[model samples]
Target: MKKVNYLDKFLLKVFILFVFFGSLYANDHPYIIVLGTAQDGGSPHAACKKDCCEELWDNRFLHKKVSSIAIVNPKDKKFWIIDATPDFPEQLDFLEKKTGFSLAGIFITHAHMGHYTGLLHLGREVMGSKNVPVFVMKKMKKFIESNGPWSQLVELKNIALKELSNEQFISLSTNLYIKPILVPHRDEFSETVGYQIKSKKSLIFIPDIDKWSKWSYDIRDVVQKNDYNLLDGTFYNINELPGRDMSKIPHPFIVETMELIEKDKNKVFFIHLNHTNPALKQNSLEHKNILKKGFNITKFGQKFHL
Candidate 1:
Protein backbone atom coordinates (compact mmCIF):
# COMPACT_ATOMS: atom_id res chain seq x y z
CA MET A 1 0.00 0.00 0.00
CA LYS A 2 2.91 2.43 0.75
CA LYS A 3 4.48 1.64 -2.65
CA VAL A 4 1.20 2.40 -4.45
CA ASN A 5 0.90 5.75 -2.65
CA TYR A 6 4.40 6.75 -3.73
CA LEU A 7 3.63 5.94 -7.37
CA ASP A 8 0.44 8.01 -7.25
CA LYS A 9 2.27 11.07 -5.91
CA PHE A 10 4.97 10.77 -8.56
CA LEU A 11 2.38 10.53 -11.35
CA LEU A 12 0.54 13.58 -9.98
CA LYS A 13 3.75 15.64 -9.99
CA VAL A 14 4.58 14.61 -13.53
CA PHE A 15 1.07 15.49 -14.69
CA ILE A 16 1.30 18.94 -13.08
CA LEU A 17 4.64 19.62 -14.74
CA PHE A 18 3.29 18.57 -18.13
CA VAL A 19 0.25 20.82 -17.75
CA PHE A 20 2.36 23.83 -16.82
CA PHE A 21 4.79 23.37 -19.68
CA GLY A 22 1.97 22.80 -22.17
CA SER A 23 0.34 26.09 -21.15
CA LEU A 24 3.63 27.94 -21.55
CA TYR A 25 4.25 26.54 -25.00
CA ALA A 26 0.67 27.24 -26.09
CA ASN A 27 1.03 30.90 -25.09
CA ASP A 28 4.26 31.36 -26.98
CA HIS A 29 3.44 33.20 -30.20
CA PRO A 30 5.64 34.05 -33.21
CA TYR A 31 6.71 37.72 -33.39
CA ILE A 32 8.28 40.46 -35.51
CA ILE A 33 10.85 42.96 -34.24
CA VAL A 34 11.00 46.54 -35.43
CA LEU A 35 14.47 47.50 -36.68
CA GLY A 36 13.75 51.17 -37.39
CA THR A 37 10.93 53.71 -37.20
CA ALA A 38 12.22 56.61 -39.29
CA GLN A 39 11.12 57.35 -42.88
CA ASP A 40 13.11 56.63 -46.04
CA GLY A 41 16.23 58.75 -45.48
CA GLY A 42 16.10 57.89 -41.76
CA SER A 43 16.32 60.25 -38.74
CA PRO A 44 19.02 62.94 -38.90
CA HIS A 45 18.21 63.42 -42.58
CA ALA A 46 21.00 64.14 -45.03
CA ALA A 47 22.41 67.69 -45.56
CA CYS A 48 20.47 69.21 -42.68
CA LYS A 49 21.83 69.82 -39.21
CA LYS A 50 18.62 71.07 -37.68
CA ASP A 51 18.25 71.01 -33.90
CA CYS A 52 16.46 67.66 -33.95
CA CYS A 53 18.88 66.07 -36.43
CA GLU A 54 21.88 67.55 -34.59
CA GLU A 55 20.59 66.23 -31.29
CA LEU A 56 20.05 62.78 -32.83
CA TRP A 57 23.59 62.76 -34.23
CA ASP A 58 24.94 62.43 -30.69
CA ASN A 59 25.89 58.82 -29.90
CA ARG A 60 23.25 58.62 -27.18
CA PHE A 61 20.45 59.45 -29.64
CA LEU A 62 21.52 57.42 -32.65
CA HIS A 63 18.60 55.52 -34.29
CA LYS A 64 18.49 52.43 -36.51
CA LYS A 65 17.81 52.36 -40.27
CA VAL A 66 14.42 53.34 -41.70
CA SER A 67 11.24 51.31 -41.16
CA SER A 68 11.97 47.57 -41.48
CA ILE A 69 10.84 44.42 -39.69
CA ALA A 70 12.14 40.90 -39.12
CA ILE A 71 9.82 37.93 -38.85
CA VAL A 72 11.50 35.39 -36.64
CA ASN A 73 10.82 31.68 -36.36
CA PRO A 74 12.59 30.72 -33.19
CA LYS A 75 11.77 27.01 -33.44
CA ASP A 76 13.15 26.54 -36.95
CA LYS A 77 16.01 29.00 -36.50
CA LYS A 78 14.90 30.82 -39.68
CA PHE A 79 13.85 34.43 -40.20
CA TRP A 80 12.81 36.74 -43.04
CA ILE A 81 13.24 40.48 -43.53
CA ILE A 82 10.66 42.82 -44.95
CA ASP A 83 11.96 45.91 -46.73
CA ALA A 84 15.74 46.07 -47.33
CA THR A 85 16.21 49.68 -46.35
CA PRO A 86 19.41 51.79 -46.72
CA ASP A 87 20.59 50.34 -43.41
CA PHE A 88 20.52 46.70 -44.56
CA PRO A 89 24.07 45.94 -43.49
CA GLU A 90 23.51 47.12 -39.94
CA GLN A 91 20.00 45.63 -39.78
CA LEU A 92 21.28 42.27 -41.05
CA ASP A 93 24.10 42.37 -38.52
CA PHE A 94 21.64 43.06 -35.74
CA LEU A 95 19.42 40.15 -36.83
CA GLU A 96 22.39 37.83 -37.20
CA LYS A 97 23.60 38.64 -33.69
CA LYS A 98 20.16 38.52 -32.11
CA THR A 99 18.60 35.52 -33.90
CA GLY A 100 21.91 33.91 -34.98
CA PHE A 101 20.76 33.10 -38.54
CA SER A 102 21.53 34.70 -41.89
CA LEU A 103 18.44 36.18 -43.55
CA ALA A 104 16.19 33.57 -45.17
CA GLY A 105 14.81 36.03 -47.73
CA ILE A 106 13.71 39.65 -48.22
CA PHE A 107 10.31 41.02 -49.28
CA ILE A 108 10.05 44.31 -51.15
CA THR A 109 7.06 46.68 -50.96
CA HIS A 110 7.83 48.92 -53.89
CA ALA A 111 10.57 50.41 -56.08
CA HIS A 112 11.35 53.36 -53.80
CA MET A 113 15.02 53.90 -52.93
CA GLY A 114 14.46 53.36 -49.22
CA HIS A 115 12.32 50.30 -49.83
CA TYR A 116 14.65 48.27 -52.07
CA THR A 117 18.05 49.98 -52.45
CA GLY A 118 19.62 47.80 -49.78
CA LEU A 119 19.82 44.92 -52.27
CA LEU A 120 23.13 46.44 -53.36
CA HIS A 121 24.69 45.10 -50.17
CA LEU A 122 23.97 41.52 -51.30
CA GLY A 123 26.00 42.02 -54.51
CA ARG A 124 29.59 41.05 -55.31
CA GLU A 125 31.04 44.31 -54.00
CA VAL A 126 29.48 43.79 -50.58
CA MET A 127 28.30 40.61 -48.87
CA GLY A 128 28.59 38.70 -52.17
CA SER A 129 25.58 36.60 -51.21
CA LYS A 130 24.66 33.87 -53.64
CA ASN A 131 21.01 33.20 -54.53
CA VAL A 132 19.27 35.10 -51.79
CA PRO A 133 15.54 34.82 -52.57
CA VAL A 134 13.83 38.20 -52.94
CA PHE A 135 10.04 38.28 -53.15
CA VAL A 136 8.46 41.15 -55.15
CA MET A 137 5.30 42.11 -56.99
CA LYS A 138 5.03 41.54 -60.75
CA LYS A 139 5.89 45.06 -61.80
CA MET A 140 8.57 45.35 -59.16
CA LYS A 141 10.19 42.16 -60.46
CA LYS A 142 10.31 43.63 -63.98
CA PHE A 143 11.61 46.94 -62.65
CA ILE A 144 14.56 45.17 -61.05
CA GLU A 145 14.99 42.78 -63.97
CA SER A 146 15.19 45.69 -66.43
CA ASN A 147 17.01 48.30 -64.36
CA GLY A 148 20.79 48.69 -64.68
CA PRO A 149 22.37 48.05 -61.30
CA TRP A 150 19.51 45.88 -60.08
CA SER A 151 19.51 43.92 -63.35
CA GLN A 152 23.12 43.06 -62.65
CA LEU A 153 22.01 41.29 -59.47
CA VAL A 154 19.62 39.14 -61.48
CA GLU A 155 22.25 38.40 -64.15
CA LEU A 156 24.87 37.43 -61.62
CA LYS A 157 22.18 35.45 -59.72
CA ASN A 158 23.01 37.16 -56.46
CA ILE A 159 19.27 37.48 -55.76
CA ALA A 160 16.39 35.45 -57.18
CA LEU A 161 12.97 37.07 -57.62
CA LYS A 162 9.79 35.39 -56.39
CA GLU A 163 6.67 37.03 -57.82
CA LEU A 164 3.93 37.68 -55.29
CA SER A 165 0.24 37.80 -56.16
CA ASN A 166 -2.19 40.13 -54.46
CA GLU A 167 -4.73 38.66 -52.01
CA GLN A 168 -3.05 35.28 -52.14
CA PHE A 169 -1.87 33.84 -48.86
CA ILE A 170 1.64 32.41 -48.60
CA SER A 171 2.09 30.08 -45.67
CA LEU A 172 5.32 30.59 -43.80
CA SER A 173 4.49 27.76 -41.41
CA THR A 174 1.59 25.74 -40.07
CA ASN A 175 0.42 28.70 -38.00
CA LEU A 176 1.87 31.74 -39.79
CA TYR A 177 0.96 33.16 -43.20
CA ILE A 178 1.57 36.39 -45.21
CA LYS A 179 -0.79 38.00 -47.67
CA PRO A 180 -0.13 41.02 -49.88
CA ILE A 181 -2.80 43.71 -50.19
CA LEU A 182 -2.77 46.42 -52.80
CA VAL A 183 -2.57 49.99 -51.57
CA PRO A 184 -2.93 53.24 -53.48
CA HIS A 185 0.49 54.89 -53.72
CA ARG A 186 2.94 56.28 -56.26
CA ASP A 187 3.31 53.46 -58.78
CA GLU A 188 5.92 55.12 -60.96
CA PHE A 189 7.78 51.89 -61.52
CA SER A 190 5.87 49.27 -59.51
CA GLU A 191 2.70 48.79 -57.54
CA THR A 192 2.73 49.28 -53.78
CA VAL A 193 1.49 46.66 -51.31
CA GLY A 194 0.96 46.30 -47.60
CA TYR A 195 1.48 42.84 -46.13
CA GLN A 196 -0.97 41.09 -43.84
CA ILE A 197 1.17 38.92 -41.59
CA LYS A 198 -0.96 36.40 -39.76
CA SER A 199 0.31 34.40 -36.83
CA LYS A 200 -1.66 32.22 -34.45
CA LYS A 201 -2.27 35.09 -32.02
CA SER A 202 -1.85 38.41 -33.93
CA LEU A 203 -1.86 40.21 -37.29
CA ILE A 204 -0.11 43.45 -38.26
CA PHE A 205 2.06 45.35 -40.80
CA ILE A 206 2.97 48.71 -42.44
CA PRO A 207 0.27 49.77 -44.88
CA ASP A 208 1.50 52.97 -46.55
CA ILE A 209 -1.72 53.92 -48.29
CA ASP A 210 -2.01 57.11 -50.37
CA LYS A 211 -5.19 58.34 -48.69
CA TRP A 212 -7.79 56.36 -46.79
CA SER A 213 -10.69 58.05 -48.54
CA LYS A 214 -9.22 57.73 -52.04
CA TRP A 215 -8.74 53.99 -51.92
CA SER A 216 -11.41 51.66 -53.32
CA TYR A 217 -11.34 49.70 -50.07
CA ASP A 218 -11.97 51.17 -46.62
CA ILE A 219 -9.09 51.37 -44.11
CA ARG A 220 -11.42 50.87 -41.16
CA ASP A 221 -12.59 47.56 -42.58
CA VAL A 222 -9.04 46.31 -42.79
CA VAL A 223 -8.29 47.34 -39.22
CA GLN A 224 -11.47 45.67 -38.00
CA LYS A 225 -10.43 42.49 -39.75
CA ASN A 226 -7.00 42.29 -38.10
CA ASP A 227 -6.08 41.90 -34.44
CA TYR A 228 -3.32 44.54 -34.74
CA ASN A 229 -2.65 47.28 -37.26
CA LEU A 230 0.73 49.02 -37.75
CA LEU A 231 -0.27 51.45 -40.46
CA ASP A 232 1.47 54.60 -41.70
CA GLY A 233 2.32 57.51 -39.39
CA THR A 234 4.68 59.45 -41.70
CA PHE A 235 3.68 62.81 -40.32
CA TYR A 236 2.27 64.15 -37.06
CA ASN A 237 0.18 66.85 -38.69
CA ILE A 238 -0.57 67.99 -42.24
CA ASN A 239 1.78 70.96 -42.03
CA GLU A 240 4.80 69.02 -40.78
CA LEU A 241 7.07 70.21 -43.58
CA PRO A 242 6.26 73.89 -43.87
CA GLY A 243 8.84 74.84 -46.51
CA ARG A 244 7.92 71.99 -48.85
CA ASP A 245 4.55 71.57 -50.55
CA MET A 246 2.78 68.79 -48.64
CA SER A 247 0.61 68.04 -51.68
CA LYS A 248 3.57 66.66 -53.62
CA ILE A 249 4.19 64.06 -50.89
CA PRO A 250 1.30 62.13 -49.39
CA HIS A 251 0.73 60.05 -46.26
CA PRO A 252 -1.91 59.94 -43.57
CA PHE A 253 -0.87 62.26 -40.79
CA ILE A 254 -0.98 60.91 -37.23
CA VAL A 255 -3.63 63.42 -36.24
CA GLU A 256 -5.79 62.59 -39.22
CA THR A 257 -5.45 58.88 -38.56
CA MET A 258 -6.35 59.33 -34.91
CA GLU A 259 -9.47 61.22 -35.92
CA LEU A 260 -10.35 58.48 -38.39
CA ILE A 261 -9.81 55.58 -36.01
CA GLU A 262 -10.61 57.17 -32.67
CA LYS A 263 -13.18 54.50 -31.89
CA ASP A 264 -10.88 51.56 -32.64
CA LYS A 265 -7.78 52.45 -30.66
CA ASN A 266 -7.21 48.85 -29.62
CA LYS A 267 -5.81 47.78 -32.99
CA VAL A 268 -3.64 50.73 -34.05
CA PHE A 269 0.12 51.30 -33.75
CA PHE A 270 1.59 54.12 -35.81
CA ILE A 271 4.91 53.64 -37.63
CA HIS A 272 7.04 54.97 -40.55
CA LEU A 273 7.67 58.43 -39.15
CA ASN A 274 9.57 61.11 -41.07
CA HIS A 275 12.74 62.71 -39.67
CA THR A 276 11.01 66.09 -39.29
CA ASN A 277 8.08 64.59 -37.42
CA PRO A 278 8.24 65.55 -33.74
CA ALA A 279 6.61 62.25 -32.74
CA LEU A 280 10.06 60.63 -32.99
CA LYS A 281 10.92 62.30 -29.70
CA GLN A 282 9.72 59.95 -27.00
CA ASN A 283 8.99 62.80 -24.58
CA SER A 284 7.37 65.17 -27.03
CA LEU A 285 3.80 66.41 -26.63
CA GLU A 286 2.84 64.66 -29.87
CA HIS A 287 4.00 61.36 -28.49
CA LYS A 288 2.05 61.90 -25.28
CA ASN A 289 -1.11 62.73 -27.19
CA ILE A 290 -0.78 59.59 -29.27
CA LEU A 291 -0.29 57.44 -26.19
CA LYS A 292 -3.26 59.05 -24.48
CA LYS A 293 -5.40 57.91 -27.38
CA GLY A 294 -4.39 54.30 -26.55
CA PHE A 295 -2.36 54.06 -29.73
CA ASN A 296 1.26 52.90 -29.77
CA ILE A 297 4.26 54.38 -31.58
CA THR A 298 6.82 51.85 -32.81
CA LYS A 299 10.47 51.91 -31.79
CA PHE A 300 13.58 50.07 -32.95
CA GLY A 301 14.45 46.84 -31.10
CA GLN A 302 10.87 46.54 -29.84
CA LYS A 303 9.45 43.05 -30.38
CA PHE A 304 5.80 42.01 -30.55
CA HIS A 305 4.78 38.40 -30.09
CA LEU A 306 2.14 37.49 -32.66
Candidate 2:
Protein backbone atom coordinates (compact mmCIF):
# COMPACT_ATOMS: atom_id res chain seq x y z
CA MET A 1 0.00 0.00 0.00
CA LYS A 2 2.86 2.43 0.84
CA LYS A 3 4.65 1.71 -2.46
CA VAL A 4 1.50 2.30 -4.49
CA ASN A 5 0.85 5.60 -2.70
CA TYR A 6 4.40 6.80 -3.37
CA LEU A 7 4.13 6.02 -7.09
CA ASP A 8 0.77 7.82 -7.30
CA LYS A 9 2.26 10.89 -5.62
CA PHE A 10 5.15 10.92 -8.12
CA LEU A 11 2.77 10.79 -11.10
CA LEU A 12 0.65 13.60 -9.66
CA LYS A 13 3.73 15.80 -9.20
CA VAL A 14 4.79 15.28 -12.82
CA PHE A 15 1.31 16.20 -14.07
CA ILE A 16 1.33 19.40 -12.04
CA LEU A 17 4.75 20.37 -13.34
CA PHE A 18 3.70 19.80 -16.93
CA VAL A 19 0.64 22.00 -16.60
CA PHE A 20 2.56 24.72 -14.79
CA PHE A 21 5.27 25.00 -17.43
CA GLY A 22 2.75 24.70 -20.26
CA SER A 23 0.78 27.63 -18.90
CA LEU A 24 3.97 29.68 -18.69
CA TYR A 25 4.30 29.39 -22.48
CA ALA A 26 2.04 32.32 -23.33
CA ASN A 27 1.97 33.70 -19.83
CA ASP A 28 5.45 35.12 -20.39
CA HIS A 29 4.66 38.75 -21.19
CA PRO A 30 5.72 40.57 -24.36
CA TYR A 31 6.60 37.40 -26.25
CA ILE A 32 6.17 35.99 -29.74
CA ILE A 33 4.87 32.50 -30.51
CA VAL A 34 5.06 30.56 -33.74
CA LEU A 35 1.54 29.62 -34.65
CA GLY A 36 2.44 27.52 -37.70
CA THR A 37 5.33 26.97 -40.11
CA ALA A 38 3.95 25.05 -43.11
CA GLN A 39 3.63 26.80 -46.46
CA ASP A 40 0.48 28.02 -48.17
CA GLY A 41 -0.85 24.54 -48.93
CA GLY A 42 0.22 23.37 -45.49
CA SER A 43 1.38 19.79 -44.76
CA PRO A 44 -0.35 17.00 -46.69
CA HIS A 45 -0.57 19.25 -49.74
CA ALA A 46 -3.82 19.15 -51.62
CA ALA A 47 -4.18 16.01 -53.81
CA CYS A 48 -1.07 14.44 -52.33
CA LYS A 49 -1.32 10.75 -51.33
CA LYS A 50 2.29 10.17 -50.35
CA ASP A 51 3.76 8.80 -47.15
CA CYS A 52 4.88 12.30 -46.25
CA CYS A 53 1.30 13.29 -45.60
CA GLU A 54 -0.06 9.89 -44.57
CA GLU A 55 0.49 10.24 -40.85
CA LEU A 56 -1.05 13.71 -40.73
CA TRP A 57 -4.06 12.49 -42.69
CA ASP A 58 -4.55 9.55 -40.34
CA ASN A 59 -4.13 11.59 -37.16
CA ARG A 60 -5.42 15.14 -36.88
CA PHE A 61 -3.03 15.68 -33.99
CA LEU A 62 -0.16 15.37 -36.46
CA HIS A 63 -1.59 18.08 -38.71
CA LYS A 64 0.29 21.37 -39.18
CA LYS A 65 -1.21 24.78 -39.87
CA VAL A 66 0.08 27.28 -42.45
CA SER A 67 2.82 29.72 -41.41
CA SER A 68 1.72 32.31 -38.85
CA ILE A 69 2.90 33.95 -35.61
CA ALA A 70 1.45 35.83 -32.71
CA ILE A 71 2.87 38.67 -30.59
CA VAL A 72 1.29 38.88 -27.21
CA ASN A 73 1.55 41.64 -24.57
CA PRO A 74 0.26 39.62 -21.69
CA LYS A 75 0.50 42.59 -19.39
CA ASP A 76 -2.36 44.15 -21.30
CA LYS A 77 -3.84 40.81 -22.38
CA LYS A 78 -3.81 41.93 -26.01
CA PHE A 79 -2.13 40.31 -28.98
CA TRP A 80 -1.57 40.68 -32.75
CA ILE A 81 -1.06 38.01 -35.38
CA ILE A 82 1.42 38.11 -38.23
CA ASP A 83 0.07 36.75 -41.52
CA ALA A 84 -3.36 35.46 -40.65
CA THR A 85 -3.12 32.13 -42.45
CA PRO A 86 -5.93 29.80 -43.56
CA ASP A 87 -5.53 28.20 -40.14
CA PHE A 88 -6.65 31.41 -38.37
CA PRO A 89 -9.44 29.77 -36.43
CA GLU A 90 -7.17 27.27 -34.74
CA GLN A 91 -4.32 29.73 -34.41
CA LEU A 92 -6.51 32.37 -32.84
CA ASP A 93 -7.99 29.75 -30.55
CA PHE A 94 -4.55 28.70 -29.41
CA LEU A 95 -3.52 32.30 -28.80
CA GLU A 96 -6.61 33.13 -26.80
CA LYS A 97 -6.56 30.00 -24.68
CA LYS A 98 -2.82 29.92 -24.08
CA THR A 99 -2.19 33.63 -23.61
CA GLY A 100 -5.53 34.70 -22.20
CA PHE A 101 -5.35 37.54 -24.71
CA SER A 102 -7.66 39.13 -27.26
CA LEU A 103 -6.83 39.89 -30.86
CA ALA A 104 -5.95 43.58 -31.28
CA GLY A 105 -5.16 43.47 -34.99
CA ILE A 106 -3.48 41.53 -37.82
CA PHE A 107 -0.37 42.37 -39.86
CA ILE A 108 -0.17 40.91 -43.37
CA THR A 109 2.95 40.47 -45.50
CA HIS A 110 1.24 39.78 -48.83
CA ALA A 111 -1.98 38.83 -50.52
CA HIS A 112 -1.13 35.14 -50.85
CA MET A 113 -4.00 32.78 -50.05
CA GLY A 114 -2.40 31.32 -46.95
CA HIS A 115 -1.47 34.76 -45.74
CA TYR A 116 -4.80 36.54 -45.71
CA THR A 117 -7.58 34.09 -46.68
CA GLY A 118 -8.33 33.55 -43.04
CA LEU A 119 -9.78 37.05 -43.00
CA LEU A 120 -12.94 35.34 -44.18
CA HIS A 121 -13.51 34.10 -40.65
CA LEU A 122 -13.97 37.67 -39.44
CA GLY A 123 -16.75 38.15 -41.99
CA ARG A 124 -20.47 37.95 -41.29
CA GLU A 125 -20.61 34.35 -42.47
CA VAL A 126 -18.52 33.39 -39.49
CA MET A 127 -17.34 35.22 -36.39
CA GLY A 128 -18.79 38.52 -37.63
CA SER A 129 -16.08 40.23 -35.64
CA LYS A 130 -16.46 44.01 -35.82
CA ASN A 131 -13.74 46.43 -36.77
CA VAL A 132 -10.83 43.99 -36.81
CA PRO A 133 -7.93 46.16 -37.96
CA VAL A 134 -6.03 44.51 -40.85
CA PHE A 135 -2.74 46.22 -41.67
CA VAL A 136 -1.45 45.85 -45.23
CA MET A 137 0.49 47.49 -47.99
CA LYS A 138 -1.36 50.00 -50.21
CA LYS A 139 -1.76 47.45 -52.99
CA MET A 140 -2.82 44.80 -50.52
CA LYS A 141 -5.51 47.12 -49.26
CA LYS A 142 -6.71 47.76 -52.82
CA PHE A 143 -6.63 44.05 -53.54
CA ILE A 144 -8.94 43.37 -50.63
CA GLU A 145 -11.20 46.34 -51.39
CA SER A 146 -11.59 45.46 -55.09
CA ASN A 147 -12.27 41.76 -54.45
CA GLY A 148 -15.57 40.00 -53.83
CA PRO A 149 -15.98 38.38 -50.39
CA TRP A 150 -13.15 40.44 -48.97
CA SER A 151 -14.77 43.61 -50.28
CA GLN A 152 -17.95 42.43 -48.63
CA LEU A 153 -16.11 42.22 -45.33
CA VAL A 154 -15.11 45.83 -45.74
CA GLU A 155 -18.66 46.72 -46.74
CA LEU A 156 -20.11 45.02 -43.69
CA LYS A 157 -17.56 46.75 -41.49
CA ASN A 158 -16.23 43.41 -40.30
CA ILE A 159 -12.67 44.59 -40.94
CA ALA A 160 -11.08 47.95 -41.48
CA LEU A 161 -8.15 47.95 -43.88
CA LYS A 162 -5.18 50.17 -43.00
CA GLU A 163 -2.49 50.72 -45.62
CA LEU A 164 1.21 50.64 -44.76
CA SER A 165 4.16 51.69 -46.85
CA ASN A 166 7.74 50.54 -47.19
CA GLU A 167 9.77 51.48 -44.07
CA GLN A 168 6.60 52.73 -42.44
CA PHE A 169 6.25 51.79 -38.79
CA ILE A 170 2.84 51.43 -37.22
CA SER A 171 2.58 51.18 -33.48
CA LEU A 172 0.63 48.29 -32.01
CA SER A 173 1.34 49.32 -28.43
CA THR A 174 4.23 50.91 -26.57
CA ASN A 175 7.43 50.22 -28.53
CA LEU A 176 5.66 47.49 -30.53
CA TYR A 177 5.63 48.47 -34.19
CA ILE A 178 5.42 46.67 -37.53
CA LYS A 179 7.86 47.86 -40.18
CA PRO A 180 7.05 46.78 -43.74
CA ILE A 181 9.67 46.23 -46.42
CA LEU A 182 8.97 45.40 -50.05
CA VAL A 183 10.29 42.14 -51.47
CA PRO A 184 10.12 40.64 -54.94
CA HIS A 185 7.52 37.95 -55.49
CA ARG A 186 4.67 37.09 -57.85
CA ASP A 187 2.26 40.01 -57.71
CA GLU A 188 -0.57 39.06 -60.02
CA PHE A 189 -3.07 40.03 -57.32
CA SER A 190 -1.17 42.28 -54.88
CA GLU A 191 2.21 43.65 -53.88
CA THR A 192 4.57 41.51 -51.78
CA VAL A 193 6.24 42.70 -48.60
CA GLY A 194 8.00 41.35 -45.49
CA TYR A 195 7.79 42.69 -41.99
CA GLN A 196 10.44 43.92 -39.55
CA ILE A 197 8.68 43.33 -36.28
CA LYS A 198 9.55 45.27 -33.10
CA SER A 199 8.55 43.75 -29.80
CA LYS A 200 10.69 42.62 -26.91
CA LYS A 201 12.97 41.35 -29.65
CA SER A 202 13.31 42.40 -33.29
CA LEU A 203 12.30 39.88 -35.96
CA ILE A 204 12.30 39.81 -39.74
CA PHE A 205 9.78 37.49 -41.44
CA ILE A 206 9.96 37.05 -45.18
CA PRO A 207 7.82 34.06 -46.05
CA ASP A 208 8.02 34.35 -49.86
CA ILE A 209 10.57 36.19 -51.90
CA ASP A 210 12.12 35.53 -55.30
CA LYS A 211 15.71 35.19 -54.16
CA TRP A 212 18.37 36.84 -52.06
CA SER A 213 20.04 38.35 -55.12
CA LYS A 214 16.82 39.99 -56.33
CA TRP A 215 16.25 41.98 -53.15
CA SER A 216 17.45 45.58 -53.00
CA TYR A 217 18.82 44.96 -49.52
CA ASP A 218 21.44 42.42 -48.56
CA ILE A 219 20.12 39.32 -46.77
CA ARG A 220 23.07 39.35 -44.39
CA ASP A 221 22.48 42.97 -43.47
CA VAL A 222 18.84 42.25 -42.72
CA VAL A 223 19.65 39.23 -40.59
CA GLN A 224 22.36 41.16 -38.77
CA LYS A 225 19.93 43.97 -37.99
CA ASN A 226 17.28 41.74 -36.50
CA ASP A 227 17.56 39.29 -33.63
CA TYR A 228 15.43 36.69 -35.40
CA ASN A 229 14.80 35.90 -39.04
CA LEU A 230 11.74 33.75 -39.70
CA LEU A 231 12.92 33.44 -43.25
CA ASP A 232 11.63 31.68 -46.35
CA GLY A 233 12.71 28.03 -46.31
CA THR A 234 10.05 26.76 -48.70
CA PHE A 235 12.25 24.19 -50.45
CA TYR A 236 15.45 22.56 -49.30
CA ASN A 237 17.12 22.63 -52.70
CA ILE A 238 16.60 23.20 -56.43
CA ASN A 239 15.29 19.65 -56.94
CA GLU A 240 12.52 19.85 -54.33
CA LEU A 241 9.76 20.07 -56.91
CA PRO A 242 10.81 17.71 -59.66
CA GLY A 243 9.71 18.76 -63.17
CA ARG A 244 7.80 21.72 -61.74
CA ASP A 245 9.91 24.48 -63.39
CA MET A 246 10.95 26.18 -60.14
CA SER A 247 12.31 29.21 -62.00
CA LYS A 248 8.77 30.22 -62.93
CA ILE A 249 8.05 30.65 -59.23
CA PRO A 250 11.45 31.61 -57.87
CA HIS A 251 12.29 31.51 -54.17
CA PRO A 252 15.67 31.23 -52.48
CA PHE A 253 16.22 27.53 -51.90
CA ILE A 254 17.01 26.64 -48.29
CA VAL A 255 20.44 25.24 -49.08
CA GLU A 256 21.33 28.28 -51.13
CA THR A 257 20.08 30.58 -48.37
CA MET A 258 22.03 28.72 -45.71
CA GLU A 259 25.21 29.20 -47.73
CA LEU A 260 24.42 32.84 -48.46
CA ILE A 261 24.11 33.83 -44.79
CA GLU A 262 26.15 31.15 -43.07
CA LYS A 263 27.88 33.71 -40.89
CA ASP A 264 24.53 34.74 -39.38
CA LYS A 265 23.59 31.20 -38.43
CA ASN A 266 22.66 31.87 -34.84
CA LYS A 267 19.88 34.34 -35.71
CA VAL A 268 18.46 32.29 -38.58
CA PHE A 269 15.28 30.48 -37.62
CA PHE A 270 13.97 28.97 -40.83
CA ILE A 271 10.20 29.01 -41.26
CA HIS A 272 7.50 28.82 -44.00
CA LEU A 273 8.52 25.28 -44.86
CA ASN A 274 6.68 23.37 -47.57
CA HIS A 275 5.47 19.82 -47.06
CA THR A 276 7.83 18.67 -49.82
CA ASN A 277 10.89 19.80 -47.86
CA PRO A 278 12.70 16.95 -46.07
CA ALA A 279 13.73 19.35 -43.30
CA LEU A 280 10.17 19.17 -42.00
CA LYS A 281 10.65 15.43 -41.50
CA GLN A 282 11.70 14.47 -38.01
CA ASN A 283 15.40 13.69 -37.51
CA SER A 284 16.09 14.08 -41.25
CA LEU A 285 19.60 14.90 -42.38
CA GLU A 286 18.56 18.38 -43.44
CA HIS A 287 16.98 19.04 -40.05
CA LYS A 288 20.02 17.74 -38.19
CA ASN A 289 22.41 19.70 -40.40
CA ILE A 290 20.57 22.95 -39.69
CA LEU A 291 20.91 22.49 -35.93
CA LYS A 292 24.45 21.22 -36.28
CA LYS A 293 25.30 24.44 -38.13
CA GLY A 294 24.17 26.52 -35.16
CA PHE A 295 20.93 27.56 -36.90
CA ASN A 296 17.41 27.02 -35.61
CA ILE A 297 14.31 25.61 -37.23
CA THR A 298 11.10 27.35 -36.23
CA LYS A 299 8.64 24.73 -35.00
CA PHE A 300 4.92 25.16 -34.78
CA GLY A 301 3.77 26.38 -31.35
CA GLN A 302 7.25 27.40 -30.15
CA LYS A 303 7.40 30.68 -28.25
CA PHE A 304 10.23 33.19 -27.90
CA HIS A 305 10.33 35.92 -25.33
CA LEU A 306 10.39 39.03 -27.48
Q: Which of the numbered candidates is closest to the native, going by highest TM-score?
A: 1
Whole-model Cα lDDT per candidate?
0.83, 0.87
Q: Indicate the residue-level lDDT of 92 in model 2.
A: 95
Clashing pairs in 2: 200-306, 201-306
lDDT of 2: 0.87
- TM-scores of all candidate predictions against the true structure: 0.91, 0.89
**Best candidate, lDDT-wise?**
2
Instruction: List the pairs of residues colliding in candidate 1.
Output: none
Cα-based RMSD of the predictions, in order?
2.9, 6.6
Q: Please, what are the lDDT tens digits per residue for candidate 2 over residues 159-259?
A: 98888889988887776777889999999888898888787679888989999999999999989988888999888898888879999978899888888
Tell me the deviation in Å of residue 101 in model 1: 2.6
The stretch of ten residues in a row with the least summed lDDT in candidate 2 is 23-32
Clashes (backbone N, CA, C under 3 Å), per candidate, total: 0, 2
User: How many angstroms is residue 61 displaced in model 1 relative to the true structure, after the best TM-score fit?
Assistant: 3.7
